[model samples]
Target: MKTINTNIAYKEEGTGEVLLLIHGFCGSSGYWGKVIPMLSEKYRVIAIDLPGHGESKALDSVKDIEQYALVLKDFLEELGIEKVTMFGHSLGGYITLGFAEKYNQYLRGFSLIHSTGFPDSEEAKKGRIASADKIEKAGIDIFIDGLVPKLFAPENVESHKQSMEEVKKIGYEVQPQGAKNALLAMKNRKDRTEILEKTELPVLLIAGESDQLIPADKTFTASGENIKQVVIEGAGHMSMYEAPEELGNAILTYLNHG
Candidate 1:
């Protein structure tokens, strides 16, 4: 397929096979701060701050998950990169699924960290809308304040205070319209379980044992000889921040042996 038009912003480091990182909602490339240094030591790492969420300009014309996947395809082609092992976190996972289904030509493999292949349930859709409304009425900061803490294991919040604050700082920078658009996209995302069920390529699923957003069981929708799943102890949704060392090791293991 020909490259679609896009102007995505990204951070690249080290040198080896490409490992693309797609951050979750309200996050930027900075989300992989600790993990990048660890993984980049052995392999090339490229972390992108998706449009409207990082330095990239918002795409007002594109409001669906399919468009987000196209944007990523163009991002890779623009850099002259041919293929990559993509790892998507939370909201990023939804986009990764879209990419895997439509743009698997560029994927060597892919992983979903603390994410699921299931679609948002009816109740979950309402919650997504509620969050968008909250951002519109109360403001982004209020929504971020309440959202960030819930992303961590409640018992470990005090210990991971610094990382929690860093996440909040990043969340605050998200463009309001961009954030709303993402919520709408997520609320309407399709079920992608079948995509994983049939893939023969290496597939890795990493879930936080204590993930407050997506349970470990939920992330394991598909299983096969080619699928590898790991559950990190004590981590919540943001494993990149809560347990970077363990998260990095899990990713390294999948890349090296899977």
Candidate 2:
């Protein structure tokens, strides 16, 4: 797919209802490599590299989640995608919440994959600043080495060596500026719990059984008639790699019946 000069880079496939896949921090559209083909079988799939990740260029400064959401809106408009279902992983989920808050008109439904609606704790905020500073002082490679391994459930790390390596590869490819910006954006994001209670659209919250970053308790915090939650067994923060089949089924079910 072509890159929009002022926005994100993306890859599109299939042809039916639109399903937008937004990658998490440190990931590009390539993060969805495994599930995109499966989802595209029944619906059009557009996976985008959020600014600063993948092949997408970095923004000049750290922008808030709202700004990231607007970037998504602009992307959809540029593609003439009037309505869509969104699946966001990690940081992608935060941007999705921002989209749900500001551009609900263009949404059919949305899912949070191993993600949360809560804003960062004060400690987490300080951690983000430190992470950014570390990247600036050192380099992205060392930072990625430390971060990528933590993303997997410890149990799965040994068994899923190839998968873990892929995650690390993507992490290593991340533009330092882009990763830093995402960290700042996530740090500043507001608690979007109200969007969960307010939007009439279907909401799917998928948590990994072993996600250390955002545990199931944090991911499963919201509840409503429109909300559905699924916990993928034996998975971690990177469910798309650890358990793509389960992730795909949850997404397909939401699209078909949500």
Clashing pairs in 1: none
Candidate models: Cα lDDT each = 0.90, 0.89
Worst lDDT run of 10 residues, candidate 1, spans 1-10
- Which lDDT tens digits does candidate 2 get at residues 80-155? 8899999999999999999999999999999999899899999999999999999999899889888888899999
Model 2 lowest lDDT segment of ten: 1-10
Best by lDDT: 1
RMSD of each: 2.7, 1.1
TM-score, candidate number 2? 0.97
Residue 25 displacement in candidate 1 (angstroms): 0.7
**Measured by TM-score, how close is model 1 to the native structure?**
0.97
